[model samples]
Target: MFGDDWLWMAVQWSPPYGERAGFDTSTTVMLLVTALVKAAFLWLILRAPLPGPLDRRARALRRLLYLAVAYALVLWYPIGLLPDAVDTASQLALWAAIDVLYLLVIRWRSRVLRAAAAALFAVELAGVADQLLDDLNLRQVHWGEVVGLGWMVGGAAATVLTVVGQWRDGRWSRGTLVAGWASLGVYALVITLNLLAGHLFSGGPAVSVIMDAAGLVTTVWLAATARELPTENSVPDLPPARLRAIRVAVATVTVLPIIAMIHPEQAARLTYTGWSTDCYDRPSFGDLKPAQRDAVFLCVARGMDGGGPPMFPESMSDQAILAYGRALCRAKDRDEQEAILTRAGSARPSWGVNPWDLVYVCPEIIGATHPELLRSAEETQAANDAYIAEENAKCRDPWPRTKGVVQATAKYFLFVDGDPGYLVHDPGDQAAEEEADKLYSGDGLVTVGRNSALVGHIEDVSDLCLTVKAFRTAPPRRTAGWQQVEEVPIVSRTGRLTVPEMGEDEVGAGAPMPNLAIKGKGRYRLRVYVRIDDGGEEQHLVVVFPGASRKKLTLKP
Candidate 1:
């Protein structure tokens, strides 16, 4: 009778504003208030005074209905043991059964009352079978109530017919008259409130408050109407199994309230609020328009250089395009978008910027250009391979540059021989004496800042030259920046070494020996800076240290 469909929606729904979700103090208070109402109603029905003519079934049905309502709200006892699905189903089923019983009770005394109750029950059972399968979703069962309102009204008309029929039969009594009116009136009031709740108070605290008040009022009406029912003298026989089940149910519902209060989360584990009727749509991203460009990162290239044209030797500009490609693609205006692309280019050469993809490659700005550079993948690999081979040729032992030096790589190797370590060796693979071949190697340590600093030993002492192009202490350690001092020449016609040794060396058939030795040990930071002839004017920084630790630092490619 109560909380079957419409009222349950309002009762179970939370206020939209705040502190609605989860088990908390406010929700507990609300739940406890409703449960107390149920318990109070149950006590009133069970112990209230009654006249001595009502059937056993009628009295039992009232008590059963009260029990179902009380236990559903007071969830702490044994009824809490049932799964929420079963609990919900049982509530609906019990109420529907009560409606059927009420129809029976009023059917005899007043045909109008009996017909009205029966019609109400029929309206409830309309989509009940489908609803059970549909999991009690209100949308599925609500349509019947739409039609039921008319049936409910029609039953009211039957009330007049019923009163006339009863009075003519000479069986009219005041109790019967009151029961008839109460039955039809209560159903009509409830149906009307339910319709109003759906149409007017759909969401908010007011809806819940209104529904709760209606439930309380309905309970009060039932209590008043039950008073008009007179009790029978004899109790009907009951099956032992049924009696045991009833006792167990009563015990369970009684115990559940205590546990539910103590452990609310567990009791509510299988419960959920109904879905909202509101709907939300998604946001828009506008559109993407294509533009003309050779580089993959043209959009980002423009952004880096302050709206100017893209330069060469692309650095991290490509990475920028890759990161913001989506947003760039979404740009609508072509010239404005192209301006973004124009600024995307970089002048500083990064590791990934090499080998020539003409699609975006720029030789003049990227240092030096070569004919072998190609945009095709196949051509790039071939060019790199040929370049590697040409470089190895100009190594320690020079090879014929038949391939026009497509590429060249300069490498430094440390040479070792005597304990003095300045001793370089390698004969020209001939008998010594008439002219002994010498080895020249920069690999050995020369503690320059210290007293012992042998720049290097050269085979052709006359061709050897040492000119300090530029010198300064390394960056941060210098504080004020690289402090430039003086440019001093260390090697001349009289080389650093005079006495020479000879032997066959690995680099070539014969190499020069280092006879120049350091005077003593000191902190040395003398390093080599090379300018590759084939790779344009780009300089490579290679720092060599002065100890047996042999630490080498290659600062850039």
Candidate 2:
């Protein structure tokens, strides 16, 4: 039904899958040949004359053939994974009820039985009507769907009403005959829809038209025989035993497909011989066997020409690409490594992502061997260093003045670092024990590492004007805030620092302010001068300069 999907499936065992854009010449030829065969069968069904005036037995046999055709065409929906199968239980109940009612009316010609069957048919028609309403609106109705729906409603109504009339009146009327002809309209409607909708057939136009022709033939037979009621001792038919056997055969045909549906994997295991050779043109490629997946990876790593989209393109899952990359990482040969990396680079479709970034799956190897390719990180660090050098060069012996003052709560802290974390004040605060172990100290200000320090304030300090000034040498310090000074040694990774406000809990809770840019990445001496006014306002000066070795030193107020 799914065109090149099934056609190409024949050769899907070939390496790589889902890469085909259109049908090849051979597939096209095969489709045409298949279409011709289907057309021939359709022609035979629709135009081939009946052998003679078919008796009741002959008509019944022909109707069985029609049933077989229907089972072949439709049973796939339920037997496969179509959502329509969810209604199986209710549909089977309806069918059983209608079938029993039909048999009862046939045997005893009960008016009640006829009415019940008519009611069941009406219920079926109601379902069709509901579907019709759901499918199209008044202003945007597509006649194709409507006609397709009519085909179903018309057929069921014709069959049931004809049987009901037979039970009640013992003869067919013009109305029942017209109803039978209307049932034939299903074939017309479906074919028309296919054309009207620009040949949007479920299994392509060829397959759909054949099915429609087959349906039309079935409707023609049923309509032609609707009035041919049997008399006593009509031409000898199959015995009871044979009739039972036929019913069993039909039931087996119906049930086997359902059994497959219930355990499709078992069916696939039994039927599927194996996959095709190494070529990626299959419908689905996700669940590949380990060996097959490895082979594909090896093929791509060897730089084998895929001739179309690269194997394991960027569109694939990172996990899949990573799996391949990890396998490539296992290769120790330098040439092989380069070949794999080159292939990985080409497969990356997105821009701004370094080719080396594609194999971040093996970051340790790539980072160690090809650090230069990690330019994004390097470029960012360089830019930050340049900005810091420029800003730090503005520092002088007399600190440059600042403009605006920021307000803060009485007891807040300034944490200076490229990346700062919350402070752990209490040694008993076990929840933050790990952070305290790595970074806490007893002093008001303590340098955690080469790059970070925590500076605390206990008194209420508002109007906090903050500024940073840097010098090539340690410039003489001048008192600023409360004549309290704390000096700490810090190392700069990218020559940049930030001071963020810490809350009363000693946790860094406010935004970092007044970033400090110094000379290039290296060890530096940092001095903080604090001045507090009697009216609860403060001013601070920070000075940074080159230094070799230093320790934390604090002067209290």
Q: For each candidate, C-alpha RMSD in Å?
A: 24.6, 19.0
Please, what are the lDDT tens digits per residue for candidate 2 over residues 455-529? 444444322344455666776655543468877776656545545444434433233344344466667777777
Q: Residue 556, candidate 1: how far off, in angstroms?
A: 74
Model 2 regions more than 4 Å off: 1-120, 127-557
Which candidate number maximizes TM-score? 2
Residue lDDT tens for model 1, 1-557: 34223333434432233543343453444455555544554554455545575567778766765665455444425554766556557656876776666655543465655666466556555434444546645345454655655645655555544444433433334433433554455455466556554433323343344344334434544454455345342223356687567447534533343233332232222111112111121111011112222232233233234544343323433434443343334445545444544454434223122223222323232223444432344555566546544543444312222211121223222244432222111122122221221222334323221122233332312111121211223322111211122111122112222223222232211122232213222232434333323423222222222233223333322
Error of 2 at 277 (Å): 33
Each candidate's number of clashing pairs is: 31, 21
lDDT of each: 0.37, 0.45
Roughly what TM-score does model 1 have, to 2 decimal places?
Answer: 0.27
